[model samples]
Target: MDLDHEPATRAHEARLWRDDGWTAKVIKNGDDDGWAVEMTQEGEDEPALVGPWTMGRDKKNPKPLDSAAFITLVKTASEVLRRHEQQRHALLHKNVTIDSGSDRLRIDLDIIPDEYEPYAELSAHNGFGEELARVRVQPGFKLSRESAADWVANNFARPS
Candidate 1:
C-alpha cells in the first residue's frame, strides 16, 4: 500500500495497529477531511472500533491528510498486524469443514513455530475417525482468508 498517493480514492484507510486480537486502521472520508479509527478483531466480520480522530496541529480541524503521514501510519499498522497474525497463527488450530452430502470431511490445520521447525499441518478426515489426507504448509506461504472464502463460495458451494 503506497501512502504517497492520497487515500481519498481508496475505500478504506490504512491500518494502524493489531493487538490483543484486534487490528486498528485510520479511515478518511472522501467527501470531507474527516478521519475515523476502525478496529477489527481477528475472525470478526466488522470493525470493533470506529470513532472520530483529532485533526493535526490546526486544533480547529484535522490536519490535511498527506502522503508522508499516511505512509508512516501504514508501515506501523502493517507491522502490528503482522506480529499479531504471526503470534495467533502460531498458537491457534483451525478447523475447516468441507461437506458434500453423504461425505462430510473435516480439515484440521495446526500452525506451529519453533526454534528448529516451523510449519502448518493440514489433515482431512471423515465424520467417522478416518483420515483422508495430510499435508504440510510452509510458514512463508501467502494465504488470503478473504480470497479463500470467496473462492469456496463461488466455485464449490451452490449459489444463493
Candidate 2:
C-alpha cells in the first residue's frame, strides 16, 4: 500500500485513506449532526458502504480515525463490494435446461435492472447449438424446470 494515498496510521482526525484500490473517508453526517464514514472503491462513482462513525470518549465528537478503526472499515467495505458483485452475477446470468422430445433445449434468463425500467429475456438453444427462440419477458417472470418443459412443448411460444 502506498503511504501517501493510504490513510495515515495512528492519527486522530477526520481524514481520507486509500489502500488496495479502496478509499475510506470520514465526514460529517448531515442526517444526525454526527460523523459518518464512506468507503468507495477506486473508479466507482458512489460509495459501496456508509455508516455512522464512533464517538470519542467525551461523546461530544467523533473519534479520530485510527489504525484499528480503519482496518475494520476496510474489511466491512470489502464485504459490501463482494456481495454486490455476487448479486449482479446472479441477475445477469441464469440458465436451465430440459429435454424436449429427442433434443435438449437450454433455457437462459438474463435480466437488466435499470432505474427507469427493468427487463428480462428468455431464450432457448437446442443441443446442436441452434437458437430455437427468444422473447422478452417481465423482470418478475417465474422460471422453473416445469416451466421450461412447458415452453418447449408449446413450440417455444411465449408463455402467458
* Local distance difference test, each candidate: 0.56, 0.81
Residue pairs with backbone overlap in model 1: 16-77, 55-62, 56-63
Q: Give me the runs in candidate 2 sitting further than 4 Å from their true place.
A: 1-14, 97-106, 112-142, 154-160
lDDT of 2 by residue, 104-160 (tens): 889988887877999888999989878889988888887788888887788878888
Distance (Å) between predicted and true CA of 158, model 1? Answer: 26
Residue 95 local lDDT, model 1: 68
Error of 1 at 9 (Å): 66
Task: Give the Cα RMSD of candidate 1.
Answer: 15.4
- Tens digits of per-residue lDDT, candidate 1, 1-160, equal 3446432323323335444444556667555677776555556667644556657676544554345554454455557668977878655576666664577666666677766988866556778959766666664434344422442445322212
Per-candidate TM-scores read 0.32, 0.64
TM-score of 1: 0.32
| lDDT score of residue 142 within candidate 2 | 77
Best model per lDDT: 2
